[model samples]
Target: METESFEDKGGWVIDQQSFVVMNSSYIMAHGMGRPVKDAATTVKFPKTGKYHLWVRTKDWAPFPKGPGKFQVLVDGKSVGQTFGESGSDTWKWYDGGLVDIRNANIKLALKDLTGFNGRCDALLFTDDLKFTPPNELEALTAFRRKLLNLTDKPQEAGRYDLVVVGGGIAGTCAAISAARMGLTVALIQDRPVLGGNNSSEIRVHLMGDVDKNHYPKLGRIVREMDNGDPGNGNPDAKEYGDARKISIVKAEKNISLFLNTHVFKVEKENDIITAVVGRDIATNQERRFSGSFFSDCTGDGTVGFLAGAEFRMGRESKAETGESLAADQSDDFTLGTSNLWASVDRDTVSSFPETPWAMQFSDEYHIDEPKSDWQWETGFGNFNTITQAEQIRDHNLRAIYGNWSYLKKNKAAKYGKKELAWVAYIGGKRESRRIIGDYVLNQMDIQEGKFYPDGSVTATWTIDLHFPDAKNSKYFEGQEFFAGTKHIKVAPYTIPYRCLYSKNIQNLFMAGRNISTTHVAFGSTRVMRTCGMMGEVVGFASYIAAKYKTSPRGVYKDHLAELTGILKGETLAPQP
Candidate 1:
């Protein structure tokens, strides 16, 4: 049985951030240093007899024996051996010996011993002792499908005029804008909620000014969904407004919002996209959405990458971009991902166990804080944010837990009553793949306030680039958990409409941090409000494309005036 499909998850959380690399979403017992509640489910055997048990898990930190140790309980009885201590850094199956079944239906549970982030992918039971589960990702996926009785064909989820494959602030506004213009839209989000980083799961507040845009009404949809700013890493989940974002989307009659759906496959003809396929995270069911135009608002450029769009992942060299902020020699260095955490003060003193497997902290080395902010980040340099996402999040958890443990032990006077309130399992990512478009905006464009005939969205944030904190590097060199930034202020500048749609992929449009821009220019335009305005511009462009029966490039090259006029509050009716 899949551990993530447990009937009662208890204190475990579903982690699907690295599903592309790991093949399946797994449940993690992230109880800081304490053991979490048991994850239990009931299963029926086809035949009551002796069966061999196997569990798919990993020893995330194998040094000095894995700290994330757990055991399987059948009817509240131990299954003999402890799992997650296999000494293998990668995911593998652990043998749980043989068990005699007296009843057809029985209760099964996973009991975590030391919750330093114990994880389980799936469990298998078979009467054949020689039958071993596949260890490879591809083979494992096929095996899972066969066992779960899932079909190879995906269910068709009707046709649409526009399909937005993300539900962040940018995608949310894009769907709303298009729906209001009479275009049938499908807004797909991987998580259960609408907001991506700003959602309650991540707790990052919205930034940038919507009222200061080139077109005053460009960010109207964004303002409609705005929850009050509660600052970054706030412990109050309601302050982030997960419900408000969903309610706004549900009110749009022309939009079909699919939450907990992750798009992984793209259907294309020649250079244009025809349909996108997504799988439900909980049900493991797939659906295909066919659309005339598509938007890649996924911050990682996930849909764009799957559609084979031209993209870049790292910084550009000074010689290549000719930007003053560009690095002397470019490498694979991009902004890191953050996993913010918070602790609350209780009336009575609280106790936290020691974490030897976690990163050890000293009085001088610890962060010495109750809550984390934007500065607490990881995954820079050689760490591939897409593939090594799980490792990066685990590293952040270690930092938070280790530091808290140190504070509880060494600095008890101030932190004795403090207890971990919330820890973000979903890593709040900043940068990844930037889909290339008709024009790549550079730093000079913003600095000189260059006039492009198709300037649509206004960007007001500074050219802020983050690096490993100098003090943090002294304690943890390569795996620094803290971040620092140098903000170069710039005048509010307009972003060209040409930078919103893909250059080669005919029907693709992009927004958010994944828009076509150099690393230096992206620093200023990556904020949410700027991204929302880009979505507004793309929505107008989509209407022009549909009315004129043209592509995104045609809208820019031949009908730029019409698109600009629509953005300036001129009314245009949708074609029947």
Candidate 2:
């Protein structure tokens, strides 16, 4: 018999005669980060039969074979109760049983003892008890094709009164409040974690209505998380500030969270949306749900676009909205994507890319300035961000690493040598497509402290713009970014309910950064806190609309008192 090590295949290696545990074999017994029972494999038999089976296992520590046993299956069925759990006294032995044969094909399966905590050796199996070429047997092409088809089709379905896309603070609150009102809700998020921009992925700090004099109800949800200030979450922290808060939200009876799922299509009937279709990453299955109303809390207005909702992108011109700061509007211009990185001190660095990294860039693309949150010019949608975060993450990594490499290798005088710190798993997005609502909030609205009686949200943030001219200036070069006119005349402004609805379509409400705000007003309302409140308003309105059997506008007109009462209950603080 020939022996092969498992470490050669980068993971476990399976062959016709035997299997080899490779790379990090210690994880097999003790396991890796998480105990993944689904990823574990088991063998079985077709029927009762006598078959030849060979087994081998390797461990960093001694194999705990005494009380722990490898389960064996015969003829697609389990045989006996269990085998091998004698409590760690034996090594390398074969036992033959006088079992009845019932099928032409037989399978042998090995299961590690529950809670086994050591490396496991690879097990060997053969029909004729002979080792041969790995690919001598025919490939299971038909089985694979069938499995693929099954995985691709959407299978899950349920009824929801309100479905909120995007699980940021806004979305989570939306789902929770709506469900509390006796409405079934589904919250879909593109990331694994919640809190949107405050999520570990985006790493932005969470902020909301704080009295400064005292805490207000607006921050009730976020305050549950003890991650220090709601705003200023340490980007380098391993976990999100509100990650646990998300767990509490998920535990709520009415809210169903679908993480790492993207809403690709919206089913509509006339002006009303019927169902939202989402895709699951693990199983590659699509999920559908029927809802009375839908909230586009995705920040980018993904649902609005799919529902044929009219929207806008980039800075709007004065000709369109009469906003003084509105520049020459163009669809190609956008608020740009964030390239996030976790900074660390040189003394405590790990997983830092070694020198001579493969993705180096020239001096032209280098950014040597020592600053936190350096914005790097990104390639335009080169990879599918929804499915592969690592794809976009790698681009940010390359941009960051390449710039550092360039500084050290070429421009040491202006840009001194720097140590490797940390990197972000994914980049954050500041702006994208904006859904055009009944109102297009302009910069002047913010400057004038404009308030609409129908306003559902109030925001106070500066109209920060990234200038194209500053793209490569000495003051700002190589994804060079600048914050336009801080401490400007902009003040607290109200966001109208009309601005949350599609001008062309009815019964759909948008929230978060993607709502019907001019580029300037979006700068303020886009903040996570305001967005969260926006979500709450939309969510409550959705429930009320369902209750009254009326349009969103109808709810605003007929049930303003009740709608305001619901919003007030959900922690929308009165503007000072």
By TM-score, the best candidate is 1
**lDDT tens per residue, model 1, 1-576:** 988888999888888888888767888898877789999999998989899999999988766666889889998999898988777878888888999888999999999998678899999999999999999889988898899787867899999999998999899888888888889899999999988998999999888888876676588877887887899999999999999899888988899999988898899998999999998876677899999999999999998899899999898999999998999988888889999999998999998988787789986778889999999999777488888898888888888888888999999999999898889989999999999999999999988877688898878889989999999999899989899998888887889998999999999998899999998898998988788878877777887788787999999999998887777777666522
Query: What tens-digit string does per-residue lDDT give for candidate 2 at 1-576?
Result: 111222222221121101111211112322111121311332344444444444333221122332223344454455454544433322232333334556544443333443222223334344443432121112322332243464544666687888888887777777776776677888887666787767765567655443321113333443454355533324455556555867777677878888767677788998778888875533335688778888888876778888998877666676877776667653345654555553334443223222242244565644555433524434233333232232344345445555555655576454443444333444566677788877787777778877776766666666666543343445334433322234354666667777776776677777778888777667666767677667666766777788888877787779877776654564332221
Cα lDDT of model 2 overall? Answer: 0.55
Q: Where is model 1 more than 4 Å wrong at Cα?
A: 572-576
Who wins the lDDT comparison?
1
Error of model 1, residue 29, in angstroms: 1.4
Evaluate residue 548 in candidate 2 and report its C-alpha lDDT on the 0 to 100 scale.
88
So what's the TM-score on candidate 1? 0.97
Off by over 4 Å in 2: 1-147, 150-153, 207-219, 222-226, 230-235, 329-331, 346-371, 374-395, 406-421, 468-487, 568-576
lDDT of each: 0.88, 0.55
